[model samples]
Target: LREERIDTVVNFAAESHNSLAVVDPTRFFRTNVLGTQTLLEASRAAGVTRFHHVSTCEVYGDLALDTDEVFTEESPYRPRTPYNASKAGADHAVRAYFETFGLPITITNCSNNYGPYQFPEKVLPLFTTNALDDEPLPMYASTQNKREWLHVLDHCSAIDLVLRKGVEGETYNVGSGIEATIEEIADLVLELTEKPQSLKTIVPDRPGHDRRYLLDATKIRDELAWEPSHGWRDGLAETVAWYTANRGWWEPLKKRAPVSEETAWR
Candidate 1:
């Protein structure tokens, strides 16, 4: 950064698979926690004025499906998985730099992202591609596990807003306020791809799977005036089409991903 005269830094690097994290937590810690601390130190050393750390809502842990409660910026951290625990540690480290070293830092914890160019490991692209090829769609422990879906483009927009206009030493929740069950998402993918519902298969769930995750993006909305612009249905349709039309982009990734029957559904 010193040699390049970098003024700002956006940290989005992480080992983000919950299943993989459970099997191998060391990599997650090395990348998400240590990597963040290293980057913060480097930014401070280089005198970077602004640091934006992109996070996930998983750090807030699971919410009861029966409740209306959503994760707010002020929510207490209760990470259940190795992936979320690593990210939560990183979030705290970023704040530590702000408080101790007076570094200008902002963090944005976003919801589930689905869009073009996403790796086939994630649910949306995974199911879409699987259905397109007449492969079984693996459902994790419970199809009832819920998540708030946000298009990647909208997530990017929210990050941009927090990076540019957000206050230092603050955390913002970024979400579309759209929630759906895993089973529902898989069904939708099958419907969109014209595949039979029988293609759905229940697979072993990852360890410590969260029952539900919902985000209250009120802070980013009220303070930064940022909200998701894409409609969920339209965005999902376009995402499925992108995978359908550009199999080459994701096919190679899936090949290298080594999806086993146990973890295929994630």
Candidate 2:
């Protein structure tokens, strides 16, 4: 990317995982922080505008229960994982560059992303494909990890909204506003696959699982008039059916093995 003079730079490269970060903190920082700076530095020198740094809801840490208050653009950074800390650092640096250099940059923090064409390590396909093959689906952590699910199309729409309508030096929170715990999601998968409940396995939980992730997208809605078109239920059904009919697509990828958790993929 540095070799080419690009008009816009979008940084979506990061090894995002809470437990993985705990295992190797340095690698997370190296890619998330150093890579971001390298791209931004090159973009600034090349006169690139409209920088979009993709971020995640893990930066918000655990949200308190009994409150419907979704995170907005003004939420403070309280990332619990090394992965999230690195992303949070990069997010801060983007703001700094825009403020100090007057660069036309936009930042958007999003929630758990799940859909078709996703890597098998992520949950939706991991669980769905495992069930499809009658393999035991593992659930890491307490299975209560609350994640705000968003279809990949919804995320792309939100990013498009930010890229087209968001002002410079601004950040938007893009999410599906539909939250679910890992346990509930596992149940959904089991129900979809017509598998018996005995297939759900509770293994050792991943380190530093965020209790709940929520996003209040009123700002984006009020500004760009964009909202998620796919509800979690509808999206889940479609996702289940997609994996069922497309066994040839995900079967080969099953060599990677099933995992405990990650952002939404269904």
Top candidate (TM-score): 1
Q: What C-alpha lDDT do the candidate models reach, one value each?
A: 0.91, 0.82
Give lDDT tens digits, candidate 1, residues 1-266.
99999999999899998877877889999999999999999999999999999999999988998998888988999999889999999999999999999999999999999999998888898899999999999998688989999999999998888888999999999989999999999988988999999999998877788998889888889999997989978899999999999988888898885647494335
TM-score of 1: 0.97
**Per-residue lDDT for 207-254 in model 2, tens only?**
666678898888888998989999898899899998889988877776
True-structure RMSD, every candidate: 1.7, 3.6
lDDT of prediction 2 = 0.82
List pairs with backbone clashes in candidate 2: 113-264, 114-264, 114-265, 114-266, 115-265, 115-266, 141-205
Candidate 2 displacement at residue 122 in angstroms: 1.4
